[model samples]
Target: MPDPGSPLARLGVSIQHLLPQRALTALAHRISTARAGWIRRPLIAGFRRLYEVDLDEAVVPASGFDSFDSFFTRALKPDARPPASVGTGLLCPCDGTLSQAGPIFEEPSGGRIVQAKGRDYSLAELLADEKAAEAFTGGRFATVYLAPYDYHRVHVPCDATLRTEIRVPGRLFSVSDATSRHIDRLFARNERMVALFDTAHGPMAVVMVAAMLVAGIETVWDAGLRLRPGRDVARIDFDPTVRLSAGAELGRFHWGSTVIVVTGRDAPDWVDGLVPGRRMRLGEALTGPRAPGRAEN
Candidate 1:
């Protein structure tokens, strides 16, 4: 467990608990969307230097972006992150630290992924849809945390057809590692976009969780999320024609945050050596061979 007494951890908790979350997030959104070169350029440069972002892989040159959001969610060179072999089962959806990865238990409703060493959040609250949560009741979940320097775009972990999309609005809490260790129901309490897909492995859900300072979450299909701070869950049914192959771009965070992937009980087992704090790139293998009796959808 992380030490809550540490200065950094203590400061994180203060920000999460004491700060005006929505106002701060709105300010961040304004700064991120600002087209003024004076504001965006230095902000981009400072962030790149601070986080050591690799501008070489970015599709647009650093000097080419008109807004911080453009550079923050920059596209990578096509070959930057390639897909794994077809039969490898599941692939990681983004570049980030694998904060938590394991089974989803049923008793409490949220599957068994840990938010921190000792803290856990329910999937039902995360998804805000009991029926959607049920599909992953006895399944698996992986939470990947993206830092400011990481690629903000997310991808499909497997070939799948979009089934449902849910926008669950909530408070925007800072999702830093320290906050995860100290804040209870951190992920569930934060605003998130849950997209359910019907894949060969079964029903898989890619949850885009918003963190403090994050402007918004956008998907390829819907550029405007229109997430209100206190609205009830907004559900969207997708046509079967909406499909994406493994490694295809799914969505992106305006600023870095976290993504949670949940799969049904029949999904493939995670590969050995995959553990908490492991840094993974997009398209890396996440699962091993399929378990007996588990059939592809």
Candidate 2:
């Protein structure tokens, strides 16, 4: 983690605040979604080369995608990311760097989760629901950062039923390492889609945060999520729930972004060696098998 007071980091974040983030992202969306070969093909080819994207892991070949956006969010080969055995804790939700992993602190006013090495953000502000945030008191949270070259789809960590979906509109800031360190409450301040799931162990929330140039975020159930910029929260409560198994696709980012997964108190102990900058892939176990005597909710 970079120093929070670093002058260079502060300057970068200050510059980001002045940029027309939404307009730039909209332009990116327009260009990346272009279907014409002359427009999309070269962009895809250049991106693949520049990022050294692993074509072998992708289900679709580089040339098969109709547009650059499709290529960026392409599905992987079936065997590329296999789920851990049933009892092995919960699965990792995406392919990215483990930016932060630790407990959600029970503060006097509200809950707080680790944002970076030296910063913290409020739990209620993050979920945009104080009651929902209370479920994770003293619980665990893992922050994964998807880069431009990484797989963008997020997955279910365990067998769970979708309980709630929330879209909290905010700034489209860059979620880069420097921004995370310099910008206070970086994840909570960005536009996010919060998915609450009811697992056998307890409630789990996956907060998918958008960054600059991240044109959109869509889930398996909801294809297109278009929200007007505002402070109001958009939410859905599923009475007839959607059950999802470990490794099932939950949602995907249009471009690079961040995901914060928070588990309730009843969840299994997180696996050891969860250090910063640890590279993770989808479906990898985050904890060991469920312990004896732990019952379902």
Task: Please report, in order, the local distance difference test score of every candidate based on alpha carbons.
Answer: 0.85, 0.87
TM-score of each: 0.91, 0.93
Candidate 1 clashes between residue pairs 3 or more apart in a chain or in different chains:
104-112, 105-112, 110-122, 110-123, 200-297
1-297 in candidate 1: lDDT tens per residue? 446558877776876677788899899899889999899989998998888989888889988998999999999999999787858398999999998888886674345557877788778788888777887767888899999899999999988999998888887887877788878889998899999899988899999999888988889888554644347778889764588988889999989899999999888888766678899999999998655775532
Per-residue CA lDDT of candidate 2, range 1-297, in tens? 455458877888899989999999999999999999999999998998898988999998877999999998899999999787748368899999999987788879888988877799999999999999988887889999999999998999988999999989999999988888878999999999999989988999998999899988889878664523346788999999999878889988888899999998988877767889899989888876445675522
lDDT accuracy of residue 184 in candidate 1? 87
**Root-mean-square deviation of every model:** 3.4, 3.6
The clash number for model 2 is 2
Clashing pairs in 2: 87-289, 89-288
**lDDT score for residue 226 of model 2:** 57
For candidate 1, the clash count comes to 5
Q: After superposition, how far is residue 74 of candidate 1 from its true place, in Å?
A: 0.2
